[model samples]
Target: MKKIQFNLTFFLVVTAAACSNRYQTNNHTAANKADTVQSKYINQPLVSHIYTADPSAHVFNNRIYIYPSHDTATGAPGNEQGDHFDMMDYHVFSMDGVGSKVTDHGVALSLKDIPWAGRQLWAPDAAYANGKYYLYFPAKNKQDIFQIGVAVSDKPEGPFKAAAEPIKNSFSMDPAVFADDDGSHYMYFGGISGGQLQRWDNNVYHADATNKYGEELAVLPRMARLGKDMLSFAEPVKEIKIVDKNGNLFKAKDNDKRFFEAAWVHKYKGRYYFSYSTGDTHNICYAIGDNPYGPFTYQGIILHPVEGWTNHHSIVQFKNKWYLFYHDVQLSGHTHLRNIKVTELTYNADGTIVPIKAMK
Candidate 1:
C-alpha cells in the first residue's frame, strides 16, 4: 500500500508542473500578440485623435517632434481657392521612436492668439534657436492676403506666443525654416494658384495678375535668410530656380516637375537637398545643390501621389536612420481633413534618393 501511494503522489506532482509550464508558454505568446499590435501600424496614421496635415518633422532633444497644421471641418464648401480649409489652430506632436506612442500637445498656437491674423492658419514649421523655439506660419491678414508670421516659445511643445505683427516684408504662404550647420537660418516659401504665388510680381502683390502657365518658366519658390533676431528677413527674398539635367529651368507647363508648395530642406553628406510637393500633380520631388539657395538640379520624385488632392511632407534623420513624414486623406477620405504618417526613406549610393510609394 505504501508503494502505490508514492506512485500516485508522484503522478500528481508531475501533472502540476506540466500545467504550470503550459501557462507560462501561453502567457509569453499573449505578450507577443501585444507587440504585433504595434507592428501593424508601421505605415498607418501616427495619430487618429485629431486631424493633422503638412507634417514638419524634426528631431529636437533626442526625440522626434512633428509640427503639423490642425485641419478642421467647418462645413465650408470646398473650392479650388481652398475656401474649405478652415484650420484655426496648431497642435504639435512628438514620439520617442517609430512604433511608439504619439503625444498631441494640444493648442500650441491658435487663430485668436494671433492678433494680426484674419483666417486660414495654414501649414507651419518650427525651429530651435537663440535658446527659444520659433513657430513660423502663414495666415491671411485683415487685408485678405496671406502673410507669414512668427511665434516664440521656450519649450519645443508649447503654448507659443505670437508676435504683435507679421514678419516685415513677408508675403505669400508656406514658410519653411532651415537651420544650417554654420548657425545660419533660411526661410523658403511661396505657392502657386490659390496659394497666391501667381499674384506676386517682384515681391509685390498684384491682385489682378495671373500665373505664367504656358511656355514660361515655373513660378519660383522664394528663400530668405532669417535675421539674427529670428523674427524678420535679413535680406530680400530670392527666387529658387529649379532646372533640368541640361540646365534648363522647368517651365510652368511642366507640372510634373515644377515646384508648387511645401518646401523642405535637409543636409546629407554635406549636400543641400531641397524637396517640395508638386501640387495638383500630388508628387513630392527633390533637387540637389551645393548651396541652400539652389538652382538645385532636379532629381526625381521622393513620393508618389497619395490618396488625396494634396501632398505635404518633411524629412529628418533620427538615431542614424532617415524617415519621411507626410499626410494623406486616408482617415476621413476628405481632401481638407488629413492624417500624418511616417515611413523609412533610403538613399542610393550615387547620392540620389529612392522613390517611395505613398501609403494608401
Candidate 2:
C-alpha cells in the first residue's frame, strides 16, 4: 500500500492565486484571444485530471454553479470497483460567467458522512427554495435499496447535511427539482427501472406510480409534484414517453421512446421541455409539451453520445444564451471515469432545439 502526501503550502498558494482578481482578469483576457478555444468555442472537460461527471448546472444569485458527481479512481475510498462507476461524494464549481475560470468549492458532501446511506452515491441535483438551498441525491441504503434524499444549506456552495432518512416510501434515483414561477415547487425523479411517478399529496409523499415492479417490462420516464416545502408528494401519476405532434403516446416497445435514466425538465417561452438520456445511454434527447408535467412529443437528440456508457445533463440559460452540461469518458479512457463538458445550445424560432455536438 502507498500513502499519498499533499503539499499544503502549494495548495494554499494555488488557491489564493485562483481567487485573486488579477489572475481572473488575466484569465479573462486570455480567454478573449481569437486563438483561444474558450472564447471562440466551448473548451471542454471543464475540470481536468480528476473525473467529474453528471453535471447539474444551475443559476443562483446571478452566478453559474455546477454540481457534479465526483468520480474516484479505482481502489480509492468508497469505490467498490476498479472498472465501473463507484462514486461516493460530490463537488461544486462556480463561475461568474461562461468562459470564466471556475472556482472549485471543494467537497460539498460525502456519502460516508451521511448517516443513513451506503457508499454508492450516484447522480445529484440542487434547488433553491424557502430561503435555503437543497441538494437532492440518490444512494443505496444499508439494505442496498436505492432511495432519494435531500440535504440543506444556506449557500449554494455548501456544507450540505443529509436528512436523517430519505424521502419516505420513495424508491428511485436521480432527483431533479424545479421551482415554478407560481410559488410552487415540484420534483421529477426516477431512473433505469421505469421511472417512478409521484406527486405532493397534502404536503407529503404518496405512491404516484400505479404499476409496481415486475408488472412492467421496461423503464418509462415518470413525473410528479413537490409540495411548497419541496419534500412531500400528492399521488402517483403516469410514465413520461415519446409522443407525436398530435399528442399520441408511442407504443410500449418503441425503443426510441423507451427511457433509460437521467430525467430533466426546463421551461422556455411557455414550453415545458422534457429531456432524458435515452435507453441507449448515449444521446441526450428531449421532448416538448404544453405543460410542465406533460404528454410531451419527442423532438430530437440534444447531444450525441460520447464514449461513456451513461449520460446525464442539465440545461440552463445564462446571460440569454442556452448551454448544455454533460460528461464524457475521453480523459480517462474508461466509461466509469468520466469528465464534465459543456457546449453552447441553439434553437429554432418554433421552440425546436438545434442538436448539440458534444466536445471531448
Q: Please give the lDDT score for candidate 1.
A: 0.92
What is the Å distance of residue 200 in model 1 from its true position?
A: 1.0
In model 1, the Cα lDDT at residue 266 comes to: 94
Model 1 CA deviation exceeding 4 Å by range? 1-42
lDDT of 2 by residue, 1-360 (tens): 122225766687788987897788977887676345433234467888578988999999999999888887656442312224568888989999888888899889998888899756878999998999998888878866567888889999997988888876566677787767786666776765322222223224344434323324444565667666766555554455557667665543554554567888888998889888864547788998877777788888888776667788999999999989888776676767888888888899988999876542
Off by over 4 Å in 2: 1-42, 75-83, 193-218, 251-253
lDDT of 1 at 180: 95
Q: Which candidate is the best by lDDT?
A: 1
Top-TM-score candidate index: 1
Worst 10 residues of 1 by lDDT: 34-43
Model 2: which ten-residue window has the lowest total lDDT?
194-203
lDDT of 2 at 75: 63
